[model samples]
Target: MNKNKALFTLTLVFALLFVWTVAEAGSSKRRGTAGAMELLIPIGSRNLAMGGSDIAGVSGVEAGYWNPAGLSQINNRVEALFSYQRWIGDINTVYAGVVAQLGRIGSLGFNLSSLDFGEINVTTTDAPDGTGETYTPQYLTLGVTYSKEMTDRINFGATIKLISESIMRQSASGLAFDAGVQYSMMDEKLRLGIAVRNVGTNMRFDGPDLEIKVQPPGTEPGAAQRPFRVPLQEFELPAQVELGLAHDVVASESIVWTVSGSFLHNNFSFDEYKLGTEFVLNEMFAVRGGYVLAQDPDEDTFYSLSEDFIFGPSFGFGLNYPLNATTHLKLDYAYRMTKFFDSHQLFTLSLGF
Candidate 1:
């Protein structure tokens, strides 16, 4: 059948991409060079609870951030979600999204993610102690996504996001794109997903903060101060590609279990491997856990735990309640173990109608 051919083509493409990602995973020279690091942070609580391994199984409005191809799984007419995270360093992230079905054509999604850095005392070369002034930094991203089921076994989607960051007066803005594909086989028992994220143009900060009023050297004492603008170096976006696989190990009326694994190839950092598991009881409650290996698992030990910044293990749970035949409420929470400071927690509320 024609649909079978399409599925085969998509599968081949995804496999090639996965191979390429693994081939380049050895490059560790680009660390910290890329800007827009916020793009690398995982967004959805459900997705995070699954240890960022939901590319093959994510659905609904939350898929706007994880893997848009899964948006096609939204069977309801409309869906909405709100999430909050008390991230590292007392930073807070707020997220919201809405998705709507478009007849038989496809699904459309809109989502916003904002990082609140709170207020910090202003410091300068002259005033290292304190300037008695405070300012907040903002990192925001607004995205629009479209997804469609190409066939019974294949789905495709894309997202275009506007990214903006501002600190006091200096600000920089840029655009990025995300594309993904999902394939299911063997009566939906097996799933594969591939996505390329944060592909965009270079960006640099420019504003009044970079402008300085200073006197030219060797000038007369009464010489007027000239305005000098410090040029900021442009940086590339933190682009990466992800490959994920998930399988329904067991499916029944009262209990279900799914296992997933993912490979992340970061252009700005070391590659990572993640394994996650989820157990659902009566289709109303779920528990999850995962382990992440940063580059080499053998090197990950208590001796080097303090030197490394990335976390390793995580655990979480979720609860779902049905309001009606066409509506339901879902709540999810996750806790991530870290090497330094404190662990991270996330909470999310989702509604379907």
Candidate 2:
């Protein structure tokens, strides 16, 4: 009877998500207008290599970013992960997360991610070429997550994130929320996940940089100028909804193979369909590959024929080593293909105890 109830709840949630996706299908028209775009950047080498298709099956500390519900599936009392990515345009991304399992209470996770834009020569209208000054931009996000297993086959989780961005004397900050659910069946070999992310208040920049001295209209040029502040418009976060499915094709003592797929509907960009597969051998080594296909809103088709999208295929591998009787260490690397710039490279280290 409990299993039946779980199934009913899952169906209801899926239906609601489908309606939301359809209702927001035209959101692509508003692409590139959202703020805090860093919230949409993918983190975690393992999932990025899988084209982020493992939302249904992702677990451990990394799941705090992908689908928080999966945090409840952590196998150890404590898990920690650190990841670094060489992003496009000479930007560097760093992420760190830790999760702790609390007996029957489930799991708690905290994560921080930041982007380094390096130093740029400060250029102004008068110094278009050289300002003899340099400044670094800061973009950071901090998240707190909680996940619990509602039943043997059902898991639920939520996260709250604080985002901060600053450049020169201007800065903006806001809060975002994320929630997800995962349901498993077929003896836990098949899984389904649904998540809503980046829902929050709008953000706008405010700082001394926006203040300027300007002469009032029709006033003498020598008249005392009035201080005027440039008004900045607030922008919404890039909200999105994701639905994912995964199934274990081969499950055994020595080998396991899983195939996964997901659909991501964006409120500020084109939709995406992701497909990926993973093969593990001896429970120690694994290889993964995946592809992403963007849906063109105008054509209503899945293809990136135009230059609007750059990311394509991705591949990666993982190595797991037992540190002791109850501890383990993992290393993962991923390479993603791109168009305009160098491909992205990511490395991650994880520990479980």
Model 2 Cα lDDT, one tens digit per residue, 36-112: 98887787778888988999999988888889899888778999999999998899999999999998888999999
Highest lDDT: give the candidate number: 2
Off by over 4 Å in 1: 8-26, 296-306
What is the C-alpha lDDT profile of model 1 across 34-93, one tens digit per residue?
899888777777668777886888788878777889887886899899999888888888
Give residue 163's error in model 1 in angstroms: 0.3
Q: Candidate 1: lDDT of 280?
A: 95
lDDT score of residue 99 within candidate 2: 93
Backbone Cα, N, C clashes tallied per candidate: 0, 0
Against the reference, the lDDT scores of all candidates come to 0.83, 0.89
> Which regions of candidate 2 are displaced past 4 Å?
1-18, 26-28
Q: TM-score of every model?
A: 0.92, 0.96
